[model samples]
Target chain A: MTAVQIIDDLVARPGEGKALLDAYMADYAPGARARGMVLDRVLVSPPLWMDDQPNTLTIVWNVEGAAGWWGMRLAAGADPSATAFWETAGARLVSRARRFAAAPEDVETLCNG
Target chain B: MAKFTALITLQPGADRDAFARNIGDATLAQPTLPGVFDGGDLILHRQVANEAVPSDAAIAHIDSAVYEPIGGGAHEPGLRNGVYRCLLLAVKPGTPEATVRQFESETLAMPHYIGTIRNWRLSRVTKASGARVWTHVWEQEYADIGGLLGPYMTNPYHWARVDRWFDPECPEWIVDTRLCHSFCAFERSVLNP
Candidate 1:
């Protein structure tokens, strides 16, 4: 099965979400090109019914491998400017990056049928 | 055969119109991608807001390239050959950090929200003008439409429990209504074979 990583967050601002997303896209652009990880789709939407939290932004990227993802993270953190950008933004980044060893078919099936 | 779906939420002050246009352009520009079969945006109705519900501005995109090759054979008529659903939501302000944290935890705990999902991450952004917003993404595969609503659309008791878990202040006033603007489109491959 394909290995996947999921990055989730609770955003604090509107424009800031766009800015961070742009930075993330840029950070992965080089690696995506180099690794041949196809750009599936970038879906941008607003928060609907999010508990009591106000400004919330959600972004999801579908990629092919873990190496490219780790490489991208390393690149993002290595840059002092990027680190500063995240620090000053007052944004909390919560990420869940995991790799699936088996294909979807080989793993446990919940309700696929 | 099961289909894949993605739900994306936009940050505050993001231009919905421009965002839709960009996605449209991207899909038109690249068509050979196997992950995306057919997709689009969802347009919401304003009247629902007057009903005291939290209306969402959203877009729905469908991808039909799953299972078999595009144009390979006839798919189930009226079933969108291999379409996948994508929903976009417009978030509001005044969302507390605690509330956000709670929401994340609750979503993760959902039965259908586990394993199949990939890249379920969130981030906060600050603009040059000092504005801030929070965003996250949920991608998963479903056997049917019920899978999407399985975790969210259920008994009121469950929802009440989730609300209490997320919001301590004014928990009773927290409603679950959302409005969305949606659309549908196909993915195109830029590089010709």
Candidate 2:
């Protein structure tokens, strides 16, 4: 089964939304490549309605398994330098939701199709 | 609270590069305001799919947070707006109402935003396989979603220019309001410390 999580109440900063997302992606890409995790599509778009909310950016990519996802996170937080970048960049760490499953196909077609 | 999963969808033929760029721009544009907290992006891909389904599409996850009421205002922005939607995935299943309410208020009033707006849903998958899948859905809508993009996409003089891209006054449904679909399979994993 697929799990869905929505992180709302995002701060209303001026340019932080785009800045944080860019920094995180730049930091995440290299490690994913090294692990044989292919770089996939990253989508950034404005909210359809709410004016006083943070903008949204949705990313899709592929990897082998749970280990692959963990490996990518480890790479992002691996070095002190990278950790510092994440910290100083000031990208607010909002809520995160994770679902356990064997594969993407086991979830549903809304995200995969 | 027990963490739940969320699935996001993009319009057909949506540009990935532009999507990333827009998210980056919106995040960067946030720090200029008050009551802002943190933000980050997550790139999700389809590792598997049912028969006859394409596994190439990507899903982008961009998130941020804000502080509780600014200056002790009466209007709780988070709950009124939809911030509670985020909290639903955070707090333990048995959290108290006060805490939940607090999170909700902060979410509604947060100031950051993107250029365009689209519909999003929160759900839990109850079943899955190559042939069949099931999910419980929750959807949210914001009236000012386009305000972030309005400054850039529309001319200053026009009040209803969005119709140029698609009709605005016809009351036609432009964005999908429901979160039901069986297009892809998703899995979740935790990031290591």
Candidate 3:
């Protein structure tokens, strides 16, 4: 079966790495799960906390396939919880981006079907 | 040179007969826009049906301002007393002019994808005199309410392709979230002279 991956690249303001992650777990993750997205893992770059330097948070998520991908987007795109989380989290973040991807071998099934 | 449309929502138990009398007596400028309508600068439409699809309550009244058509206007003879839908929206401030034009072009492409629309017009608002500063007015005529709530809403082009401009989660999103999605009944073809 084909699968789709969603990655969120977020940079937290200096001294805000931990606080932003905590807030994401508390506010954003629940809504994401309800929208059919499964959290895979989260990674922080530079491997250490810094008071004066920003930290990059990479969040990985998974869905079944193209149908699942679109379903998640349609739900999340209108979800007020998602909007509220980002608006409120804006204070603790420098920048954020969401990316979609799939495994190399499953690309054909994901795109064609 | 300018197109205007107003979305009016009545209070939950407001008196309709009194409001109709006042609106009928209201003065309006002469309409310069090409289209078939009774003499007036603004045409009043009371919604026959309304439902909130994604968000916000359905508007009860629509005040469409007169103007010369700028870009798109269409009509199909013999389609009358049908659904006339209008969308009032604002492009967020600070979005590049080029991006706004792109969004406009994308919107104008809807007829190509959905064949149910009988008449349509897309115009930019020139005046800002309302509670919300709306930037655009997108109007369409349909054979029935099902034409709008069914194929138009379910088309992939609508939800998948063009919706990104309105979807807050999209990076390409430039439109404000507050929008007036309202429709009403019309006797004559509004997009034809």
Native contacts retained, all candidates in order? 0.00, 0.00, 0.12
For each candidate, report its DockQ versus the true two-chain complex.
Answer: 0.02, 0.02, 0.15
Candidate 3, residues B1-193, lDDT tens digits: the string is 4444444444456553444345542211111122322212223432211111112233244434333344674648657767777776778999999998899899888888777777887877655434446778788888887777767775556654677788777567888776666665556655552
Query: Whole-model lDDT for model 3 versus the true structure?
Result: 0.67
Interface RMSD for each of the candidates = 15.4, 21.3, 5.3
* Best-to-worst ranking by TM-score: 3, 1, 2
Best by TM-score: 3
lDDT of 1 by residue, B14-33 (tens): 55555544443122211121
Task: Identify the CAPRI category of the predicted complex in candidate 2.
Answer: incorrect
Q: Tell me the deviation in Å of residue A62 in model 3.
A: 8.8
Considering TM-score, which of the candidate structures 1 and 2 is the better prediction for this target? 1
TM-scores for all candidates: the values are: 0.26, 0.26, 0.61
DockQ, prediction 1 = 0.02
Alpha-carbon error at B10 in model 3, in Å?
A: 3.1
Q: Is the docking of candidate 3 incorrect, acceptable, medium or high quality?
A: incorrect
- Taking chain A by itself, what TM-score does each prediction score? 0.43, 0.47, 0.94
Best-matching candidate per lDDT: 3
